[model samples]
Target: MERDRISLTVPTHTDSPAQQVVQYAQNKDPPSRPLQNRLRKTLFIAMPPKKRQSDVVRRKSRQSDVQPGDPIPNRGKRRYRPGTVALREIRRYQNGTDLLLRRLPFSRLVREIAESVRPRGEAMRWQSQAIQALQEAAEAFLVHLFEDTNLCAIHAKRVTIMQKDIQLARRIRGVWGGLG
Candidate 1:
């Protein structure tokens, strides 16, 4: 019995490269679905199933069950009227009635300075009212100095208050000569 042998060689083409490319492209199988649809199908298969609304567990708190018209149950802590203290303090500060610096530190600093400047062998004592008055005065002076410095900075077309701005402010106020 004689067996027939088939040739497994690529056929030689006399066609141009562009024509061959077109022929090769035409011979290739087209996608059944769009690229986006294929990707969506693959992602859907890879993703876990989503929980339904009934399947999801929700926390039920006392606050959540309360209606808008109902009064809030007190937890034994004192609660102030909203914005009362904050707004009052802001207004006091704006009107130059409130002290900006902390009381304890300012009083300590004033005491130390007073002690250092006092005559040797002399004892110095300050009343609470005197210390409070001193702190208020110092804070007011500082606020005024800061305002002047800020003006100097603004004049120099800068937002930041630099040492130069402070120096300029002090010079303008005639206080630069004695301090330096």
Candidate 2:
């Protein structure tokens, strides 16, 4: 029976005598069948050699046109500075009233809540003026609650408002129940 063999060849560029000796020994004794199989598997899966960082060439971007000390031109959307209103926000403020709550939906919700609480035989109806007043009060209450919740989160050195922060805010405001 003819046995299958695999040979390992070392690079000729190796100048060291020790490397040459090792190469000769490797060539003299071919790898066993299992070792040859492992080598074949590894060869198939082996990744290509990575290029050194020093050898890599970076292409110049448009910013290269500017001198070393000069500022690079802003190419895209400009960011709003602190306390500066965006153009869209300014347009929105001009186009609509500054009220956060929409009257129609809020009034509907208020009427629904009142109807749910009233006795079955009794009817509940809200005046336009009363609904407007309720909407304003609800908006103010919500804004204050959110501000307090945000402050609580800030106090805890966190940027995100959590359920605990809201509960703490409600506790401070003397409100009884939260989402819990």
The TM-score between candidate 2 and the true structure equals: 0.45
lDDT of 2 by residue, 1-180 (tens): 233343444343443646545655566553333432332211122355666664444324444556688876779988788546755676775587567777788888898889889978788877888988887777767767888899999999998899999889888777543223
The residue-by-residue lDDT of candidate 1 on 27-58, one tens digit each, is 75433544443221111113455666654444
Per-candidate Cα lDDT values, in order, are: 0.66, 0.66
* Window of ten residues with lowest summed lDDT in model 1: 37-46
Where is the poorest 10-residue window by lDDT in model 2? 36-45
Residue 57's lDDT in candidate 2: 40
The segments of candidate 2 whose C-alpha lies over 4 angstroms from its true place after superposition are 1-97, 176-180
